[model samples]
Target: MAAASIFAVIIFVAMFLLIVLDKIERHIVTLGCGALTLIVVFGICMRSGKAILGTLAVGDFFKKDFWYQVTESESKGINWATIIFIAGMMIMVEGMAKAGFFRWLCMKIAYMVKCRTIPIFITFMIMSAVLSMFIDSITVIMFLAAVTIELAQLLKFNPVPMILSEIFCANLGGSATMCGDPPNIIVGTSLGFSFFDFLTNTGLIAGICLIVSVVFFYFVFRKEIVTENGAEVDMSKFPNPSEAITNKKDFITSSIIFGMAVILLVSHSATHLTVASIGLFIAVITLISAGKDALSLLKKVDYKTVLFFIGLFIVVGGLEETGILEYIAQFIESISHGNVMLMIAIILWISALASAFVDNIPFAATMVPVIQSLASTSGVDISTLAWALSIGTDIGGSATPIGASANVVGTSVAAKNGYPIGWGKYCAKLAPATIIVLAISTAYIFVRYL
Candidate 1:
């Protein structure tokens, strides 16, 4: 049994390394490794004749407690609510995109900023952050990156810096709200943290980070952005913001549904409704309003992303089932001597660094229970640990192109448009800003919670 556990751990680590290296398709690696862990571990237990079935256990599957383990594993590993919420939001975002709402918004910003490079960059980054607070960061990146690329091409300016800045801001903005990022949604729902609570706690830090990031980008991209002959481009060539609206009816409908979703999400605590439920309800309403175009909207949802999440849940579930996460938690607690402040710092830094290499969603899911366990044993506030973990994971993903969903989407969009940013280039260009924001987050955590 011990050897089997070790072998499972080795396979899990190898799979994680493959994911971090991004040498293969992530969904394939995750699903394959997850299935292997379950099968191999269950077979080992059955062979050893160590099956312990409780009274409620049933049938051959339950003989070795395999079914029970799977049930428990899924309960901790997979967050169905978060998955459903993301899927619903993807549909809503698609509806809005098809309606030209995002394009209209982008055009409006471009018109407001005109040819002023600094103002244009700042406005776009701020908009990305603001939108990500309500919408998924990846969706925010998709629309924002496209508009930015077009704007950059029109003005004959480099779009890579602008796109990268928006990606970072989008992730930062997501940390401010419960519905902003998948990790935040998972942590909030698991710990019962309210939207307002996130606003007051993590929101403050995220806001500060947004401002700091804007200044950081300004300096980093100053040469590439600030054109000596700024007057060369004619603003008249730009499309009128009003003209960007292709379908007024669809725009209005999407707007109303989106607004209602926001209101419901904000008041989730008072109404006792989960954020996922609100998102799903709004998605349904949008579909009904779309009438015959409903199928088209549904088709726009990112099913691949949803599948990736499902695989991620099972992979992490295997770790929890094997007691590996508990072992990690114990190791951390022992090293920190159960000091709450040190533990907070450790979790923050470790999560930040780990999330920089791997996806934060699965990492957050794995850590939530571990953090909870540590908090319960150390007599620290779970809310505090949750906040630390949330901020860390949210900001850390900015360090690399593969770090977060927004980064991946933004980089891919840019690459498709003939501006391929390599991993080293992305890290060199964005790491400073990410590190600065991370430091600010750490300081804010100590000041606010400690």
Candidate 2:
């Protein structure tokens, strides 16, 4: 490897370690690493007088030449499309949240279940899965956790089992759609896979995983979810679900816009429109519909996360420029000996296991380029590898607490409600179930795709 490539690997590894440690805010670490990537690589190129951003000066920052030189490829750009799409989704979710859509939905589900312990447990898991298909899993789990805790307290059952089940299902279900999980968005957008592509390829497998997860978790938590014999389960204690809706007009408006955006995503191939346009359009429509409260709706967008993607993209772009991704792809090819099945299996299991312990978003971002390089090196089917990676990262995060954003949020919500679940307990209960689902997904991919 060259000196520049080695330095890029060092910076990339440092960024990964910092994120896992989480001592500093992740956005800060990624942004800093991204800046360092450009600076360090530019310095290396300057010393050698090369053209890896070596010729462009400060004045070219705003020129088309800069983007042409820097972001000339899908694997080597800031991916503003992903940023805009995510920001749009976030604002849409916030609009629905402000209108109390999630709360009403939760309360409605609770009412329909009518205090049956098993029904409540299964229904919430299904809800978690379904809701996460469109909205963020973390956001889905956030409101779901609050409602779940209240039901558990009222019913005299342990919330840990129910909460864990919900988190696991959310991760699995989030894999079914392009906007469901951040990694899916990153992969789908980067690879030019449309929404329907995700729905067809991963959605079917994810649905199977959801079923596997639901049954496995029910048996795992069967004893804990039982209510006391003397506990009074009264339906009168719960209020009307419709009462939770704060603004009827906003709820209706947001619902329509959210539906329209999803429809556009699903038809992206036929519409000939980029996902970015659809996302921004939805966001604007949502804000405009909010009337005088448009400014407040604007605040709903998570700028930190948007910025985080920017930094991560730049950092990954540096790796691509330094040719480290190509090196890794070559290494994988040598290891697999040109066997496509072996390559798929290796990527799937390794991705799943690695993602179980760390945040899958950055790992997925880093792997996108390597996977692209692998496609060029080995001539393997791109859809197969993309699905393998999508399932691995999407479902893998459910194995441990820190693996995904949804798990972290769900854990905090449970702990605050006095139903704390330790890391050992969480892994002991969920790791096996997660592995089972991963195994099933592996076989499906190997036979169907490979």
Candidate 3:
């Protein structure tokens, strides 16, 4: 490897290991790593006169050309579109939360399940997956986890498996839509793939996986659903599902904005707007129409996550600039030997295994460029490659509690509720199911796409 490439690899691996350890705040680690990448990796390249900024003379800072070059370089380092799209979705999902959207959904699902163990398990897991298709999976899990715990308490059964299944399903459902998961948001906005494109391709596969996964979980969890206290919940004690709405007017407004975001995503091809623009535009419209609560809604966005992505983008961009990703791409190509099916299979399984342990956002962000590089080198279909990676990252994320944001949120919720599911317990139960889902995804990709 070249000196810059080696340095890039060192910084990236160290960062990945730190992140996996979760010893420090993720944003802190990623931003620090990003700065290290620029100072070390890019600095080495700068010494060789191959860096993007070239020589930054004092006079050059005043010139428009120099500033333009700097702006272009920064653009390459951080995808503002992906960052903006994530912020927009965060605000939108926050708005929905303020409107009690998730609570309403949970109440409705709770009612329909009739307090039966089988129906409760099936309905909530399916709802978690289906809701995650559009809503943020973390938010979906928060409401679902809390509510499922209550249901479990009343029905006299353990809720740990239910929460795990929900986490798995939420991550799985996230794979089916462009805005469903953070990884999807990163990949979709970066690649210019529309919501419709995702739904037609990976979305089809996610739906199939949902059905099969539901069956797999049902069997595993059936024994746990046995009620030790009582087999029935007092459904009469629950409030009417409509009572979940805090404000009818705000509910309608938030729903319209959320729905409009999805519509704009689907029709972006005709509207000639970028996916990033569509998301941000809807977010802005939401705030403007939200009246005085706009600032509150804006404040609800997890800026910590935004900063994490920003830093992560810089770190990955450093790898791209220093040619580390290209090297990995070449290795993948050599392993696959120019076969598209082998490439797809390799990308899918590697991503799945890696994402099962790593945070999927950083993993997806890193792989995005690698996929592009592989596409160019091996002349493979970029869409197939992206879809395979998406499926891998999405479902594989649920194998461990720390793997994805939804899993993290779900576990935290479980912990807070006194149900504290350990990583060993979580993986022991969900990892095999994740493997099954991954196998199903690989076959689906091979049979359907190839």
Candidate 3 segments exceeding 4 Å error: 47-76, 226-233
Cα shift from native, residue 59, model 1 (Å): 19
Which has the greatest TM-score?
2
Candidate 3 CA-lDDT value: 0.81
RMSD, candidate 1, Å: 5.3
316-373: candidate 3 lDDT, tens digit per residue: 8778887788888999999888888889988888888888888888899989889988
Using TM-score as the yardstick, the better of models 1 and 3 is 3
Q: What range of 10 consecutive residues in model 1 has the weakest lDDT sum? A: 65-74
Highest lDDT among the candidates is held by which one?
A: 2
For model 2, where is the 10-residue window of minimal lDDT?
A: 65-74
| Model 1 ranges off by over 4 Å | 1-4, 21-24, 42-77
Cα lDDT computed for each candidate against the true fold: 0.80, 0.83, 0.81
- Global CA lDDT of candidate 2, please? 0.83
The backbone clash count of each candidate, in order, is: 0, 0, 0
Candidate 3, poorest ten consecutive residues by summed lDDT: 66-75
* Residue range 1-450, candidate 2, lDDT tens digits: 377677778888999999889899889998998877777764654253343343222333354422222222243467666777889888888999999999888888888988778888999999999889888998899999998888888888888889999999999889999888988888987887778889998999999888888888888898888888846578888678899899998888877887898788787767666667777788888888888888998876778888888778877877877788888889989999999988988888888988999889888898888899899879997778889898999888888898889999999999998988889989998899888988999899987875
